[model samples]
Target: MKPLYNFILSAIGATLLSGCASSPDHATAGHDAAAIMPASGGPLLPLPGESLVPAHDPDDGLFMDALSSWLEQNNAPPNTQYEFTRIDLDNDGRREGLVLMQSPHQAWCMEYGCSLFLFRAHDDGFSYLSEISPVRGPLVVAESQTSGWRDLIIHVSGRQNNDARNVALKFNGRGYPSQPASAPGLAMNMLDVTGVKIFP
Candidate 1:
């Protein structure tokens, strides 16, 4: 009886120690997940009135209503199609905004193809930057390490049949892309000039 009691106590002690050891690991795993998950259920921008062909059919009326309310409040103007492509460009957990507009002047340039606009959610509100025209399949952000600085790269492509072009826009301390020192030496490509700092 005495030996049996000792064995039971030993087993209980081992279980407790194992649980203590795993507690920290479990906590750390949770922290990592939280850091990677985008913020959900925030106040989204309102949808415009003329009604958008829902990115998904059988639209959720509640979402549409909230979107409509946002559009009216922001005065987004007529004939602008706002598409929220939830992409986390900056890796900030919160998804950034991708707006596609089909204005007559702008629309004509694309010839009915969609124009891509990226917006970063700022403390005050959403800030719209340049129209991203890809030289390849799609314009994507690339980062690289140079001699003594890091570069924020943007690739812009021309029309469908054109070879994919490259534009290396550098960024500095505050995280904005710097202007190209010289011409990209490529024709029919747009460079980022949004005053984003560029590192040498």
Candidate 2:
């Protein structure tokens, strides 16, 4: 399983071949600090249907089924197929699901980004937590926790020469919000697979 997981990470990283030519300088500011503004340029173009939101609940213990249903409800591209994984992100004695789906719009994929969905473990079922579109890096579960739930960190590379950065989303009882004010944790280089931390 470790080999398979690493392969997935490598595949996802490869998608960044057409990403920003250079990585941005990592910020040393506070967690709540605002990201560095984009470089000067012409007026921004309108981004139609850029945001994606979960429209329905996921089936219990079924990754593919839930993903298919979600795509239909959201009217995603007909030919879209996703890669997914289920892990106990929070070490809560249950597993949570993560899905990565690429968009059909090449123009919007300047960073080789994809739509990311996080699912919360329910009673034998999974519930939609939140969605983030155009996420550029591997979705990693942090070694830190907030309010008992582990933090989920994602990297966002620059689009059209914009700066690349990572953001952490902390669970808020319901789902991890789009932009969390502050999360004091570092991103792990690999996914958490140890089953020793399971909650009793």
- State which candidate has the highest lDDT: 2
lDDT of 1 by residue, 90-182 (tens): 533333444333333353125324444444433223443334432122333343433323333444444356634555544333333422222
Show model 2 residue runs off by greater than 4 Å. Answer: 1-61, 106-112, 159-162, 179-200
lDDT of 1 at 124: 24
* Candidate 2 local lDDT, 1-200, one digit each (tens): 00111011101111111112122212211112232111111121111232221223222224333434444445554444344445555654455666555435452233446556666654435556666566554555665677887776765555446534456767787567643223333344234421221101
**Candidate 2 Cα lDDT to native:** 0.42
Per candidate, the number of residue pairs that clash is: 17, 0
Q: Give per-residue lDDT, candidate 2, residue 151.
A: 71
Root-mean-square deviation of each candidate, in angstroms? 22.8, 18.0
